[model samples]
Target: MNQLSPNRPRASDQMWLDAALDLLVEAGVDAVKVMPLAKQLGLTRTGFYHHFRDREALLDAMIARWEDKNTGNLIDRCDAYAETICEAMFNLQDCWVDWDLFDAPLDNAIRHWARTDADLKQRLDQADNRRKTAIVAMFQRFGYEADDAEIRAMTILYTQAGYIAMEIAEAPADRIARVPAYVRLFTGQDPSRNEVERFRARHGF
Candidate 1:
């Protein structure tokens, strides 16, 4: 009974996922419904079925995307090569400034959504644990003791999470200027002038 043209492809899953994420970031999780998403994408509801089983499936995909980008990239940055803890701190700080590497708005939205959904909250907890554990390992690699590393890791994660939660707005140049002090405070060692310059250059400051 289907007469769809073979050449015309249906909307891809990423398109649906991106639309859902936009809605979620703008209006919260309740706004991420299938009809609204299909309408936003200018695609038929029938086409959505090809990519996701149901609304819940689409939401699960959103969470997976969030974890893949935010949590996964942070871990990758933590594992990136750095000669000193300060350099490693800069590597991790790259995520704080780069939206592509870490979607702060989506992260904040997910945290808000998790408050109402117990399953999501549990998954969020697991993600936090994984992030903190990786950060602790990064510190330990630079010769920090277990307790010291754990405290520093928690400080770094919690501080950035607070910034995301509060939605603080600071100019890029201003934030970059504070990097030296931040690195020093977080790592207990001041970054060299050259290290700070390199970090700024990497961010085009």
Candidate 2:
């Protein structure tokens, strides 16, 4: 839908990043080389070079765009959903895991890159902090007094990351479908349905 398209002065930067992020999703980061982006966008290398200095510059641009769009914008959007802490936490977790926002191969590639790239890892750390802050706010609203926000946040993040990893594995859908139950356990929420509870216990989650 070209959702990242910016108005006027930022237009060229937006176009370049849209092409880069698209390429990253469709073909993986390694496939987002300058030549392919130019070809895909029907632009010459001269045009691309005008917007981005080089491949690393393009990735930096993409990371900036991601931080602005996902961490800054989307997190604010989450506050409009629920009132209480547990409800908000579950809802936010549910919203974040929506398939529309997740691309398994792209996710795997980003994690791989983060391992060796300190700059990208720093960016991820910022996003991670924002998420934890939001989650801690939710927990505080639920009457939890531990003040261990960072610990809770890291635990939740690790669980979500592990869940994504499990999804990418060869596990059958019937088994992987227990993710919601595991989510309930981690969030300390009681499942509304017997089936959900049964699923949690069955998975030892």
Candidate 3:
């Protein structure tokens, strides 16, 4: 008699969420429906039901995942210890370079989805505010005035966001070459040679 393997990988809520995110990036939110995700995962709809009550429940989980992992993690990284303002800026750069942590594609997908969903738009706005507030806090830690910190934080955040939105493709070497300039422009001081070299080494440039 044929028997199912006892060790077969069972589908989890995170697996469904990951599949939904992949579909969101590949085909947009419209294609993230339960049937499509189930087909993509090679599982039946019953697997999805075990994790999510409905499509709306799955969407809510996805949004929460985005907010917690992407937004909250970035803020935490910015708050990491650094010896100087320049070092702090470099620390934040780690968030930008590490795609797995920041997930630009998913961020962009959510922004696009927010266009059609008012509630999501409001949530995005709140996330944006929290991110900016965290950045400002980072600057203030370096003794920058509140007004200065706010302006500089906005400049840094918006510039990175714009780069991701424009989808500009550049070689690793090219981007590495420009990091010092970007850090200087954002922080009003150039990163030390050690800081730059450490960054390059981190990205294998």
Tens-digit lDDT track of model 2 for 27-89: 666788988777777666767777778898888877776666555543653464554444455
Rank the candidate models, highest lDDT first.
Answer: 1, 3, 2
The residue pairs that clash in candidate 1, if any, are none
Q: Model-by-model lDDT, in order?
A: 0.93, 0.62, 0.87
**How far out, in Å, is residue 101 in model 3?**
1.7
| Candidate 1 off by > 4 Å | 1-10
- Give lDDT tens digits, candidate 1, residues 169-188: 99988998887898999999
The better candidate by lDDT, 1 or 2, is 1
TM-score of each: 0.94, 0.66, 0.93
lDDT of 2 at 106: 46
C-alpha lDDT of residue 84 in model 2: 45
Better of 2 and 3 by lDDT: 3
Worst 10 residues of 3 by lDDT: 2-11
lDDT of 1 at 175: 90
- Kindly give the stretch of ten consecutive residues in candidate 1 with the minimal lDDT sum: 2-11
Which is better, 1 or 2, measured by TM-score? 1
lDDT of 3 by residue, 69-92 (tens): 889888988898988888888878
